[model samples]
Target: MANDFPFFKKQSNNWVYTLLLLPLWLVLYLNLQIIADFLIDDLLQLQNGNHLTEALRFFIFETPKVLLLLILIIFLVGIIRSYFTPEKTRKILGNKSLFTGNILASLLGIVTPFCSCSAIPLFLGFVEAGIPLGVTFSFLIAAPMINEVALVLLIGLFGWKVAIIYIGTGLLIAIFAGWILGKLKLERYVADWVYKVQIGQSEEEEKLKFSERIGGGYAAVKEIVGKIWIYILIGIAVGAGAHGYVPEDYLGTLLGRGNWYGVPLAILIGIPMYSNAAGIIPIVSVLIEKGVSLGTALAFMMSVIALSLPEVIILKKVLKWPLIAFFIGIVTSGILVVGFLFNVIM
Candidate 1:
């Protein structure tokens, strides 16, 4: 059906249609809040300060907003990833010093935003391309944990300070933890299937024409957004529930900064609850407003997005239990340290 649409097909004239349609997407995205407000305030006849009304408004407003952001980010990221194929990544990082490769790979994670499930192919590709385990780990960690959407949302919802802190710590965690894993030389633990698989070489890299990149972007929106939209809806639903009825004082008592156990407890709780950063930010905001400590809240948020149980289960396809356990331990410890340090200093 998509191929039957002239603009959707890969064509020389695709950029023209892409440019023409972007404004329409933007206009609709910008008006979502108004629509949410109308439904909550006028149609539902809900009071402004009421928690139930606020939660419903948030759910209504954020669901579409997050989906739109995911589409836009995924499309752009797909175009970028088109340039950085597994072969290309291997060629570039394959020969570099391990430390340097880990750093570069972690930085690339910001732009190449593959989620947990989507990351497995890249992980396998990296291994097949002869990319080092440590470097592969860096990319894997960074891709989902510190992607552009998460960073942008953090900055928008919190201040630049919070966003910067998250980015810096996330990078550090990916790099050093990958470095540690690299030093451990745990190659024997990787699933045999990953080592056995091979990918064919691709054609030479030429600059894709503008239209081709646009088509690639369109394909990305379809593929990536289609897979994760349901997760986004579910995450937002969970966030809305927390926003609407969770007692603020109870949250503060449990996860507040002064509580020494808050960080680890938050981490433990967050691991079981899966969410993307977009879906979790609304709940984070409410948690902070309710007096949960910033560090603890951040630890909870990161654990939910980056180290969720679902991601661990998905990774089990390639990583054996020991390596997976190690990866989790190192990351969890790093997050705990970050949480404690931030709570003390900030």
Candidate 2:
């Protein structure tokens, strides 16, 4: 009975509920500022001029606005991802030219969202599917760094220019880093047990009804938003605190281009940290507003998201320590160059 159930069996009759709620969601989303102002100014009778009041206003406004965006984007991406299963993705990457595979895998990472926690399982799948290590690294790097959630938040909060620069630089790094790693012939560094582990053949994916696709979207919202909402809130809250209390030019003095050690320091501090783009973007926005250089902030953001300690830890399960170190070394070198380049140019 459970196997026979469709994706949205219960929701098949719930279209009216969904349609009715979308307008309400849109109305609330469109007036988030007004709502935040009403709550802070009118309802709470808080004056707008004070730091505490502004902080509260920011927290109230950003929480809902970002949540709404996350729900929408994650849902849409989820539906799109239903078309790209792990088996299919590996098959696509299999038997590809090393250089081309990195490019394709990096692009594919944009649509198929997988986080660091999923890395071990995905690596096992890659092993079973006979996918190249370099291609898998590209996908892993790009997925968390330039994900749709990050792109949407950057575009929505910052603007198109920042978003484009972030995406462009991110793709290039993923492609080249993976390509370099591939050219090094690092397959010998993988764990012997990993290669020996056999997996069953993947069954063909079934075509689904339109409603099923919609169901996939809802599932994505539930899973993704549920996982990262806290990180988003914490990031926004920190941003709000800095926005309210920190003096202008404080961060600039430390992390701005004026400081010779700024960019490398930011990346060094960021590598051990862990957070997705949605969580880190809010902080990055504050950094920029406080006169932090774009390149430095971006380097920090990419290092936190793409080269997180957690990812490295998980990958250690399948990769020897030497390969892991080289992986970090290569990716860090690429990130450092991007950071310095942008700081100089922009």
Candidate 3:
């Protein structure tokens, strides 16, 4: 009797699967946008009034909505990711042509939602698996730079155009930087201890069942949401304030559209900060609206994603100084190129 359902039938191809999923994805996207819009607009309306009650009301309503949306999305992505066993990923990467592996790793990185803080463990795992340093760097660069959180937030606030550019440029940077580093033969810079890890066993052997995946997703939501709630609130509040209050002329003068140094300054400023991709995205949107060059703002964002001081510190455990510095230099140049191209084109 269940076979009568045409939609459930597997044909010669899975095109129908995508056709079915696309509508579901669209619905989710729309629902998310509606919630974001309602929260932001209502808060703005209340702020127009000059009363403590209204101010408190605004805070009470908007903050929770933003946080809820973020957590829900993270859990959903985690659930999707749980289906992707790392052993399957390793098989794909095992072919290991430098160019192909770099591209594949960078693309894989975008969908894997680990932040810079979690990157060290993942990096160690990749090294122990005998993945090349450059390919691993591609994963490292792409992970934080093209996070699902940032992509969703961008689509919610700025629409798909900005989001596409952000995602595309990030992958390009990761790919090129990884390839360049591979060509440079920078493997010798790995901490000597990394070479000694036994490779027969991999973390991917711990497979979660469907029930476990759901449970893991819930745990991921709780852990990630709990930790970043304050940061998200503060970051969004600062972005909102800037949105309402910052003078465009002031921003223009500081990060003028055509200024060559603007991109470099953005990267430099972002390097010392310890924000994740999600935290910095709202700020990037605000900066763009306030007349900062697209290149400059994006470069800043990429730097925060790839070169945060804390991330570097964590990498120190696995990499010698020279290797770390080389990684930084290569990725920074990639970001600069991306920044310049977008500024010129868009």
Candidate 4:
């Protein structure tokens, strides 16, 4: 009966699946927005109060909402990713020219929720599945940089325009960086030890059923939330402090357009940090409010998200120093360009 609909018949099964998921996605998005709104409103009220106890109360209240949103969103993304067989991904990526493959791979990366540590295993999986080094690099860069959690947080905090720019710029960086790296023939720069490890048995046959996928998504939410709870707390705490106490004039003076060093300093400051998208965005919001240039703040956020110390450390296990350095250089330049662009435009 459903197939009788002309529109449904015209669209492929993948599009059908996407349509089916739309309602769930919308519900989750609305829930997250409501939670964020509640937090902001409550925090504002606390700020209005002169009592010293208000700060502690705001912290205690807002933490749970943030954690809950993170867990729910992460779990949903994980469950969806669980269904994506490496073989299927390879098939889509295979036979395509380098340019097309890099673009596809970077777009695909936006849907995955892999962290820096998880990227190595998945990177190996992509290689084993016969995906090209450059295409795989595109995926690796995208997965951590433009994830669901980050996208949702950005949309919730900054509206769709900024979110779209962030996503678009991130993909551009990944695609071009991967393509350039691939042209350099840097595969030899992968560590010798990585090659020594035997490829494991394929798990494609063990694909989860829909119910199982849902369960796995739930578990993923719990696991990720547990691991990153501290980072979220610390990041938000700093943001909240800055929101309440940072001097706007001083921030404007330092990070203003006249200060050419502000952008580079923001980039440098972001490199060593180990915060996720959800955690860093609130901080970015605070910085922008305190007079940080949008481009500088965005560059800082991208640097932190795309090239963290831990991410680089994890990549070292799979990549040689030369390749890793090249990756960093490409992405850093991309971030800087994006920063300057936003500064000029916004």
Best by lDDT: 2
Which parts of model 1 are misplaced by more than 4 Å?
Answer: 1-6, 21-72, 113-115, 118-121, 159-161, 191-207, 222-247, 278-286, 310-321
Assess candidate 3 and give its TM-score to the true structure.
0.75
Looking at model 4, report the run of 10 residues with the lowest lDDT sum. Answer: 1-10
Q: Which of candidates 2 and 3 is the stronger one according to lDDT?
A: 2
Instruction: Look at candidate 4 and give me any clashing residue pairs.
Output: none
Model 4, span 243-330: residue lDDT tens: 4564569877787666887888888899999777767887787787688988898899999988889888888888989998999898
In angstroms, the error of model 2 at 177 is 0.7
Q: How badly does each model clash, as a count of residue pairs?
A: 0, 0, 0, 0
The superposed Cα distance between candidate 3 and the true structure at residue 103, in angstroms, equals 1.2
Instruction: Give per-residue CA lDDT, model 1, range 1-346, as digits (tens).
Output: 2365665765777767778778988998999989999998899889998878887888898788777766777778767877766556667777767899899888877765465656787887788877889988988888778865676556545658998999999999899888888889999999988888867766777877766776787877776567656656765666676664545598798888789999999899998899776667767877777778989988888888778788888889889999998888988998999889988998
Better of 2 and 3 by TM-score: 2
Candidate 2 Cα misplacement greater than 4 A, ranges:
1-9, 40-53, 244-251, 282-291
Candidate 3 residue spans exceeding 4 A from truth: 1-72, 85-88, 113-118, 203-207, 231-246
Q: Point out the worst 10-residue segment of candidate 1 by lDDT.
A: 1-10
Q: lDDT tens digits, residues 1-346, model 2?
A: 1123353467564365457768988999999999999999899999878989998898899889878987887877887997877667788998888899999999988887576778888888976676788988888888878887787777766668888988999999999999998889999999889988877767878887666677777877777787778877876777777764545577789999878688889999999999877778877877877878989999999999888778887888899998998889988988899899889998
Candidate 2 to truth, TM: 0.85
Rank by lDDT, highest first.
2, 1, 4, 3
For each of the candidates, the C-alpha root-mean-square deviation to the true structure, in angstroms, is 4.4, 3.5, 7.7, 8.2
